[model samples]
Target: MIAASDLPEVIPLFPLPGALLLPRARLPLHVFEPRYLAMFDDVLKTPQRLIGMIQPQDGEDEGLAAIGCAGRVTGFSETGDGRYMITLSGISRFRLGERVEGFAPYIRAKVAWEDFARDLGAPEQDAEFRREPFLRLLERYFEARDLSTDWASLREAEDERLINSLSMLLPFDVSDKQALLEAPGLPERREILAALMEFALHAGDEGSEILQ
Candidate 1:
């Protein structure tokens, strides 16, 4: 429920590869690294309690991707072993800006929020989504990879929820997931998602234990 004016210009960043957080989706994370644990401590003090979830770009020395999503800390608990378990509910996507230089331990970045203003407005609906076909593809994709899922839950989810959740949870390539995250809208994202699954199924590696 954070207003656009309340969103901070600069926030703590977590540069994990292959992780994507789309608007309104929830991502759960386990914080064990000392620096991130410290980050959570500092972040909890802020009113927004937001963190930037970005992926490190591909290659040995590439920097962060151009876009990332900001998520608010919704659920938090501390483990006896000193690790922190937290859930981030995605708020909006932001365009990456310059990294703030200092001794804050974890990375912090200046982000611009204008391009993705739609993220904060309301949940989206994709009228073009055909559930039966998409679910058929998903079932084949899951079965091909020996993956198991709750069919009932998927059938019960809304279009945006199902597509966005799959985009985040799927084992697509980092680049592919990034494409899904960067998709201009839900319909476009759904297209990319379906294409990716179709490609994977026909990629001649159906027997592979895990998605590549």
Candidate 2:
């Protein structure tokens, strides 16, 4: 476990609403918003093109969760006109140590990663309590959203792949998303995501037909 102070610090942050970056995940983001555009500029200037990806409470930026994950800029490029598109690769889980005033119109945070060493080789799979429920709920979620998911891809994904993909792409509320970010492990996160998906699916079905 690396110390928070020991982790390299990067200025400027990318705050995406209703999104969480879990460890070992790959997230692609389009940068067009002015604040994040400025963030890109700052990151382009240095080697520390890292950011703390945190989720704020629903409809409220002032109320942010204390825990977040650290993402390093893995692949980034610009079009001929200077529009920046980038991919964020999750490195480790981190907690917000303090609030930084302003780096580039976006909020900055002092962060410390979790002390425990996560063994990627072990896979950290939650076979019994998680797999089936998550898939079931995910199917229902897709139906409710009127989305046509590629089942072949979904079925082939491993635990980390499934969890990370769902965490980023799930259409849950900000608070719900934050909870997934703060969830302890694959088992817990999978369960919570299942429940949330079920809730959204049922609630939408009851109130209005999303398919219509």
Candidate 3:
């Protein structure tokens, strides 16, 4: 459990559009590119073992989105071919401050974590989230996409887990996923997820455009 004060001021930034890592969620990444392989190696030697997952803007070279989630490297393996398979466990969301240039081969950023201190603790199980509506919309979206999921496990997941998992796994556009990442809390994120799923079900093959 990382405390707010323990958060690092600088972290390596991995800019992957449409990939999100909410607090307490886990995201697996395959690191093969030389720059990122270097980043992975550097993180392994650091005590914090942290990385920031952010989304790069689609056009105009406007740099990264203001917010991103910081993940701790909880699982790691180095392949004989010099690749890395790693799992990052989300610690908290952070607001980007300024880009620092000295990291070499990869980007690093100054981050602010005060706004997301709440993420350092587990979400309350009894939080006021509308589960029935969310589940209904999720089912509809899944059916439309011809996607199969483990219903039993999804049904038993805690609210925070369910919402965060769906937000990360859903095929929404990069902007929509960022909305979920930047949402104020679990209930609001749940609401946005349901709304996005409902919209997707109605938009047919063009649903991603609606999310944009």
Candidate 4:
């Protein structure tokens, strides 16, 4: 039930390479690196201890992508070793505004949730858009992963949870994960997921399954 206006208008986000935060999911990050430890320290000083988690572009560890999800500091406990053990509960995805320059160690960017659409129920388009393809893609994904799934539970799950969980659980490459984070809407995201799952399965068709 939370909306864009209820959250902080501007948030300093940590741009992490090879990681993505999808709405309604928890992204746990270990902050031992000096840069990210500094990032956590900066969060403690702010009234709104929220940080957007965005994946860095290929070959670029410092620069951020145009889109990322806003994450609230749901879990924080310092370890005796001085590293931070923290968890981020996804709120809403935001658009990256600009990079903030400072000596805080980690690169940060301003983000706004205004343009981001909160993924809730199924889109207004059609049940068919979500139903048939989603089930098919999920079935293929589980089979390919050799995972034993509870079909009954999956059948009862809503579209948002199904899509978000799959995006996180699947062994997709970093660039593909970033694409999932940037997907326009639920329907569009689901469609792209269908394509990604199919490609992953077929990528092994040359008689060489890479994941093996």
Among these predictions, the greatest TM-score belongs to 1
**Lowest lDDT block of 10, candidate 4:** 118-127
* TM-score of every candidate relative to the true structure: 0.94, 0.81, 0.92, 0.81
Listing every candidate in turn, what is its Cα RMSD in Å to the true structure after a full C-alpha superposition?
Answer: 2.9, 3.6, 3.4, 3.5
Q: What lDDT tens digits, residue by residue, belong to model 1 across residues 12-64?
A: 99988888998899999999999999999999999999999998876412688
Give me candidate 4's TM-score against the actual structure.
0.81
Off by over 4 Å in 1: 58-62, 205-212
User: What TM-score would you give candidate 3 relative to the actual structure?
Assistant: 0.92
- Worst ten in a row by lDDT for model 1: 203-212
lDDT of 3: 0.88
Score candidate 1 by lDDT. Answer: 0.92
lDDT of 4 at 177: 88
Residue 6 local lDDT, model 3? 81
What clash count does candidate 1 reach? 0
Candidate 1 backbone collisions, by pair: none
The residue pairs in collision within model 3 are none
**lDDT of all the models against the reference?**
0.92, 0.71, 0.88, 0.74
> TM-score-based ranking, best first?
1, 3, 2, 4
After superposing candidate 2 on the true structure, give the runs of residues whose Cα lies further than 4 Å from its correct spot. 1-6, 9-11, 57-61, 101-105, 115-123, 129-133, 208-212
lDDT of 3 by residue, 166-207 (tens): 999988899999999999988788888888987877678575
**Over the stretch 128-167, how does candidate 2's per-residue lDDT look in tens digits?**
6555656777777887788787888988899778886887
